[model samples]
Target: MRFSAGFSRAAAIAGLVGFGVLIWAAVISPARDWATSNKVALQTSRVEAARLDASIQRLEQEKAALGIETEFSDIWQARQIGEATAKVQAELGEIARAEGISLRSIAPLQSPDIPFAQAVAFRVEAEATLDRVVALTSAVEFHSPVLIIDRASLRRLTRPGRISPQPTLLMQLEIMAPVFIGEGEP
Candidate 1:
């Protein structure tokens, strides 16, 4: 009976050990592994979220700093040629007044294709001496008219011996420039 009791006690301990190993394999180990995987996944998602948040913050900062109501790409096209021509005319008039040169003609050429945005050609003939003509040409380039002065040729016309209003110095000038746009499209 004593030997049997000892054997029974040993058997009970062995059974308990096996049951403990089964529990570790079936529940504890798998649960721990599952928890570890979830932690890694959560960490990855947090990092991604942080990156997205950083991008959004950068865009917001740019918007605030620049005070931009519209993106550059969204802006409409075409140029305002008439307003530019008028501006150029005013500037040319001022130049003529300052240089003591009377413009014979301020003809505007509206062509479909010209080097400038508006393709404007000004047939400006003036009754001025050679020196005044040179000064006027230089002044036109610098003034608000912003004429490119692509081509310029000065000719001394044959002045009749009698008093006539014909200009002794004739200037043919060509200018090409890009026009600006405003609230309205051209």
Candidate 2:
């Protein structure tokens, strides 16, 4: 249809006003509520971000010290008190045999697996020269696998009647190492 310029101008103005009212009703009014919702959401996100940042900082600090603390915690599960004791004795025997030292006995001591620290001890009796005793201690110190010796003592024993009495050496020792839970374990 064809219209006059004056009427078309009035119709266009009316249409514009109607469009503005619709825009204000649908968008502007709801935008206020949305601004409130967004404020709450933003606050929640900031709290979560702060928490995550704190956690990351803590983990990074631990990682810097030990390289990887949580990953190595599994060592506790792999450690066995009895197994470690046997390994110590067996290794001592091997070293003693190689050094021509005779192993007489081992008085195994108490082992208690506490959460932060654990300990195992053995009182070993052997007969060897002073040099051999030192060598055994060095070997155990350097060559032991997943084991540690907290203390060791060597004593020289005297023979009563022998013309040339070779010295009998004895050792008292303590060992400590990490203990952990196995995979998929509590």
Best prediction by TM-score? 2
lDDT of 2 by residue, 86-135 (tens): 65566656866886667777666677565554555566667676777777
Off by over 4 Å in 2: 1-63, 67-81, 112-119, 160-168, 177-186
Tell me the number of clashing residue pairs for each predicted model: 0, 3
Q: Give the top-scoring candidate (lDDT).
A: 1
Poorest stretch of ten by lDDT in candidate 2: 177-186
- Evaluated at residue 2, the lDDT of candidate 2 is 50
Write down the TM-score of every candidate.
0.45, 0.47
lDDT of 1 by residue, 80-128 (tens): 6576667666666777889998777777765436431334445666767
Write down the RMSD of all candidates, one decimal each: 13.8, 14.4
For candidate 1, the C-alpha RMSD (Å) to the true structure equals: 13.8
Per-residue lDDT value at 141 in model 1: 73
